[model samples]
Target: MQKSRLLMKFQSSGHTTAVLRAMSYASPSSKLKDMTSGIEFYDKITYIEEHFEEEKDVLVQKL
Candidate 1:
């Protein structure tokens, strides 16, 4: 168990690092847009996104 736990500690491989870097470099909204491109899902995605934007605005206003 100790040996496996030690192995698991270094969980990320080069591929994982590459993927994280790519995702970090892109705008998160663009990533969401890629997944929500279908017509049926677009409206639902936008509605949820609007709520997120509203919450962000409120937090920013408080600050």
Candidate 2:
């Protein structure tokens, strides 16, 4: 049991670090405007990886 808990703690910490790194490298949102119509468009932004989400879900369940 002790080993299992320790493994989980390590995995959680690693996933957290990965999430932070991914967020730091993700591109900031950018806006674009049409020259003729003067309409603005915004790009969809991604802050984290999908694998992180899955890892988090698993960690939460284990806890």
Candidate 3:
């Protein structure tokens, strides 16, 4: 779940796509498949925004 938030933030900020590529190489245990499922994107974002309330600077730094 945490990793998914990181990936989404990376994507939202227009990183060089390296993040997505790296995710592809991640082990199945990372739950990359669940993260990549399109249906979960918005929900995950909402969850992150509501729960983590992550600051933009922190998010960018994590990416």
Candidate 4:
């Protein structure tokens, strides 16, 4: 159960990172409109990646 939970969290974090990466390349007007929210999402991804490094590292290795 704990392993499944960790995997779920790691997958969600990866999705969050993908969204932020997309936002990082958005058009200037869209970026300006959403920059603050995008930053928050990015920060959340960083926090999760830092706190759950083991799970994240496994995912990275698999990919």
Top candidate (TM-score)? 3
What's the TM-score of every candidate structure? 0.24, 0.23, 0.31, 0.26
lDDT of 2 by residue, 18-43 (tens): 45435544533211111111111101
Model 4 over residues 1-63: C-alpha lDDT tens digits?
Answer: 433554465476877745655666766654653344445444545565667756777667766
Best by lDDT: 4
Cα lDDT, all candidates: 0.46, 0.36, 0.56, 0.56
Error of 2 at 60 (Å): 44
Ten residues in sequence with the least summed lDDT for candidate 1:
1-10
Clash totals in order = 0, 0, 0, 0
Candidate 2 is scored at a TM of 0.23
Sort the candidates on lDDT, descending order: 4, 3, 1, 2
Question: Regarding lDDT, does 3 or 4 come out ahead?
Answer: 4
lDDT of 1 at 4: 38
Candidate 2 minimal-lDDT segment of 10 residues: 36-45
Error of 3 at 18 (Å): 29
Q: Model 3, range 1-63, lDDT digits (tens) per residue?
A: 655665676577644344444554565633465355432445566666776755666777888
lDDT: the better of candidates 2 and 3: 3
> Which stretches of model 2 miss by more than 4 angstroms?
1-12, 27-63
lDDT for predicted candidate 2 compared with the true structure: 0.36
Q: Across residues 1-63, which tens digit of lDDT does each residue of candidate 1 receive?
A: 433332343253545434543564486764554344322244444454568766777657766
